[model samples]
Structure formats: C-alpha cells, structure tokens
Target: MQLQKKTRSGSFNILGISIKLSIVILIFFGVVFLLNKVDFPSPKKTIEKIIPNENFKIVK
Candidate 1:
C-alpha cells in the first residue's frame, strides 16, 4: 500500500502576489533609471494662455 501527502495550494498565494509586486516595482525603477539617462529636446515654441477675468468669481 502507498500513501501520498497533498500540499496546501492556498499557502503560496500570498507568495505569488509578493513576487509579482516585486517584479512590477523592479520594472518601474528600471524605466525611471533609463529615463534619467535620456536627454529630450525642449519645446521650440513658447506656450501662451489667456485666462479671462470673467471666469474668476469673487467669493464673500
């Protein structure tokens, strides 16, 4: 006669979530690192916005 021991599948659920979270955090940090090393061109034109005074309401 042979016997088999069944493992609990629920016990490793948290471990899986933690591993996924760490991988996401690692990828985010890697992207930030690469972005820091890059130099992007600045805008050639100046942005101008005209805000009408009527849009502002004075509150008592």
Candidate 2:
C-alpha cells in the first residue's frame, strides 16, 4: 500500500510540473505577439565624427 501511494504521488508531481511549464511558455509567446503588433520609432538624425590616426595603436 505504501509503495502504491509513492508511485501515484510521483506521477502527480510530474503532471503538475508539466502544466506549470506549459503555462510559462504560453505567457512568453503572448508577450512576444503583443510586442510585434506595436510600432517603435526609429532615430532620424545622422551624426558624423572623424578620428585622427594619432589615437590608434599598432599591435604585433
């Protein structure tokens, strides 16, 4: 009787863990889907800089 209880409890634990894992996966995908639907702004201004050769070091 004790052995039977142990096996049944182990199965229940596995089932619970799988359910929680699937829920987490679903929530992650839902967040990704919502983010895809939204539009984000892009940077419009362009800046240019020139670096002098004196700032660089030559390595062997």
Q: Which one is best on TM-score?
A: 2
What lDDT score goes with residue 58 in model 1? 94
Error of 1 at 56 (Å): 14
Q: Which ten residues in a row have the lowest lDDT in candidate 2?
A: 1-10
lDDT of 2 by residue, 27-51 (tens): 9999999999999998899888999
Per-model TM-score versus the true fold: 0.49, 0.66
Residue 54 accuracy (lDDT) in model 1: 92
What does candidate 1's lDDT look like per residue over 1-60, in tens digits?
889777766456888899999999999999999999999999999999999999999999
Scanning candidate 1 in windows of ten residues, the lowest lDDT window is: 4-13
Model 1 spans with C-alpha error above 4 angstroms: 1-12, 43-60
